[model samples]
Target: MNSWIKLSVCFGLCFSIAGCSSLSGMFGKDADYRKNEAELAKKLEMPPNFVLRRSGDPLVSMNVSTAQMLEEIDTIPSFRAEGIRIESNLVERWLVIEDLSVKDVWRGIEQFLASQGFKVEERRLDIGLLTTEYLARKEIAPVEQELTMISRLLNSWRDEMVDGIYDRYTVRVEEQASEVRVYFSHHMMTARATDTTTAWRLRPYQPMMESLALYRSMLYFGAQQDHALQQINTQRVYQEVKEADELVGLRLAATLNESWDYLLTMQYRANWQVERQQPEQHLLWVKIPQAATADQGFFSRLFGSIRTPGLVGIKLTPVSGSTAITELTLVVEEGNLNPKQRQQILTDLGLLTE
Candidate 1:
């Protein structure tokens, strides 16, 4: 196992050279992250016990940008993988969600997030991530209001493998009242047996549910609970909300595609479609190009290109899904209703959502 990891990492390092191999004139061709790990660690205050517990193949990516990936590359076990640069804009746009309690996972996330200096926060939602970005901006409506849109968006994602969000609802101490309450209402969607994981991802088979029909008797007339607005500038509050909501798409990206491909490959089934009303102000659900996609040969091809430490791609429609996810529901939780702001968010994420 140790030998195999060493080998994989070595090969990965070699491949990483595609971005920038010999910076001869730039730095005399001898400078490298590895030789400087100790000095870098002192400057970065990076802890050494990071990769101690891992005993298997250290994950890696395709051609990556060394300068772009250096911060993360430094802390990642130094187990030997070639460095490559990730798109800065993509680096600038990253998110991750995890169960959050796991120490190893949290530690890794913390270290990586710090190295990247992303504007990160912890919430009740099940996500953990490290990003080398500073591009996201958020706006909000209400926690309950946010949930409504998220539920609706999930429903639409099933129909279209595409995912997006033009607006957001988030609850943080600064964003929401110190006392927060969330209400969830699910919209039922049928999942064709695409794969075990797809079935699981669609409806949380990990936590089975009974189709219990429930209802609310009254309309949500804005603030149901009373609290002073603490000198809150609605405009500033609105801007923060928009920035926070922007993360939902990036966080959910990996799960969208991963879930779809894994499910379909298990069977010979896969298909979906998405339509966006506008590019800047809308979510465009794109079809994963059929000809451009390919089948994985072994564990290498299956997981090889998956080494992006930032936004692991979304696991979307499972093989169980007889079609691709095409119905992109752009839930604008809050916006100027001004077309430009909406368009920028969609365009940046490159979702077929609008």
Candidate 2:
């Protein structure tokens, strides 16, 4: 019996070692396989004039810059099993999922919001937009560690009262080629004490909250927890370009033609209604929606005070003596927009000039 037990223990130890070795070998091969695939994908390049079309959309010519074109091509083969990753610039961050269709991604988003107790207030699948109703959550102020008796009593009483902050999120999902991009915009309202009564005032964009939302959505889409967290923490940095306080104009490191293509793509992604365009002069006139500009809460919109949309002219001109640079300028055509409103529009268009 003792000889039999010793032989069994020796066999178990050998099997465990073999299993570990096999797993290590498999992981190493996977890493190398991915590396080789990426190299091969980079070797494959698309022609400058290659036309691409979105599902159910007209074929769009590829007039983008060489760098942008190559960047897009390189990302085609790097999709993991979950097919999700983060893409960001200096102004904003968005998720790019390659493995899922628009409908599947939309369904996943709905499920995620429902799990978080948020109701969809507005949905336009044709335009790939979803707006959530204002979700009010209590904000508990932190109590002092070494509080006096009076302070402790006050803290206890305040804890019993309800003080809340409200957040409304707008998610835009755009399908381009083989990838579906998801953009998240946050609007917040906080309680402000006035002389007569408390009012809810609009707060600035909460980027961390937006990041948290993206992280959760990635998890919902079957991304591994560690991978999702790593992707969320890895933010891309871009060079800063200075502009006016109101973001009237900005410069791009591309030719006039490239700039035109870039802005046209931006208009589509932002859902900007293009009233007219002059490709000969590289000019476009677009209308900005009221809901985007006003940033009103649910109650404010319920009162039926929505404003008319604003029209703006976008003009692109080449920098003097430089074929590789272009300057973009915005001119308000129709409604009176404040600096804040103009900035908001620019941000929505992903043009953070300031």
Candidate 3:
């Protein structure tokens, strides 16, 4: 009876150890996950019409231009792919894009202005002019450096309101020889407060703001951020001859070719009609309307009997000694022009060279 009990106990112990081993094997550390992952991926089914996209070529030959590469890819050429630079002088600044069509530049400018939240008040496709409505906004608060607790508390208590300012921009696009130039002009209005009331008054022109706009436009047109910033910071100084109050001619630090282009651009900006161009003689015939009828619409001029327009002659002459300098003079041919009229015409043209 003792032997039978001992054997039975041994058998029970062996069975209990074997059962524990079986349980551990069933619920132990997981199997190789990498193999399981491969199996799962193989078993998974892709959705219908699914196509894997491949990467593009990582290397391009140095001889191939960006436009050529775009062509090879069957992609439309954009301003970003074209050569772009900023040209500025004391009085004006403009963006120059090479190998781009005027239509492309015009479309890009429109898109850029729209993206910047500017409402187009006027646009003339024939002359490539765009004017935006006044964009009103509160002035930005001045940054405070190393503020103290008391100062912070006082600032918090203050209303933190800022005066309102309005900004309007004018953009002109001109095609020069093989390049397209974009000009930006800015006007501003600010709120003035007095003891009795506050009113909006015309503010002085801000060239810095115009430069910033040009910088932003450069980025919009596909210029590299660093390159655009560098171009904006780089200043090009042109020698300007300040004429006496009596003189009517304007001196420009540009070649004859450049002056001709500038004159064309001025005509567009001033809404002057060019009767004819004498390139050989370096003369441009323009018709200037009187102030009374200057603001009249095309139909009004067409239907309404109007006074004869003043015929003005513009002469471009190269400076005596310098090949890069040109002198622009105005001569009234048919109608008499007062000093103010001649001055105004010169002033409008002077913007390009000023």
Local distance difference test, each candidate: 0.28, 0.71, 0.71
Candidate closest to the true structure, highest TM-score: 3
Q: Mind sharing the TM-score for model 3?
A: 0.45
Clashing pairs in model 3, backbone N/Cα/C closer than 3 A: none
Instruction: Give one clash count per candidate, in the order shown.
Output: 70, 0, 0
Tens digits of per-residue lDDT for model 2, 38-129: 88977775543454333443223444457876776755423233678898753468988998888988887887788888899999998999
The Cα error of candidate 1 at residue 85, in Å, is 17
lDDT of prediction 2: 0.71
What is the TM-score (0 to 1) of candidate 1? Answer: 0.17
RMSD of 3: 14.9
**lDDT of candidate 3 over 1-354, digit per residue (tens):** 999999999999999977764664567744455666898987775542233222333435545577876665653233554789988753477999997799989888998888788899998989989999988766557647689877877887545557567788999999999999999998777666779998776654555567778889888787888999888776443333344655456677788888788777756655667889999978999875443244324324442453344677988899998998888777766555444555555544434221
Candidate 2 wrongly placed segments (more than 4 Å): 1-81, 149-162, 193-196, 238-354
TM-score of each predicted structure versus truth: 0.17, 0.44, 0.45
In candidate 3, stretches whose alpha carbon ends up further than 4 angstroms from where it belongs are 1-79, 143-161, 193-197, 238-354
